[model samples]
Target: MCLLLGVLVGRAVPWMQGWRTRAAHRAAEQKLDALYSQYDDIYHRWDE
Candidate 1:
């Protein structure tokens, strides 16, 4: 029983950490996209 519990914990920990990494990456991508959109808008306005 102890061995089984240990194995489950070992596997679950990394899987949970993977979600943190994914969330960080997603947030960064969104920030970059927003910045790019703002830049495009400014450039278009300047062109007009």
Candidate 2:
């Protein structure tokens, strides 16, 4: 029983880490996109 539990945990830990990494990366990309959009809006308004 202990061995089985250990194996299950070993598999889950890496998967959970990968999921967290992807989530963080996606969040960062969204933030960068929003900043760029804001910059573009300001630039266009200034041009007018």
**Best-performing candidate as measured by TM-score:** 1
User: Which residue pairs overlap in candidate 1's backbone?
Assistant: none
User: Candidate 1 lDDT, tens digit per residue, 1-48?
Assistant: 999999999999999999999999999999999999999999999999
Error of 2 at 26 (Å): 1.3
Clash totals for all candidate models: 0, 0
lDDT tens per residue, model 2, 3-34: 99999999999999999999999999999999
Stretches of candidate 2 off by over 4 Å are none
Provide C-alpha RMSD values for all models, in order: 0.9, 1.5
- lDDT for predicted candidate 1 compared with the true structure: 0.99
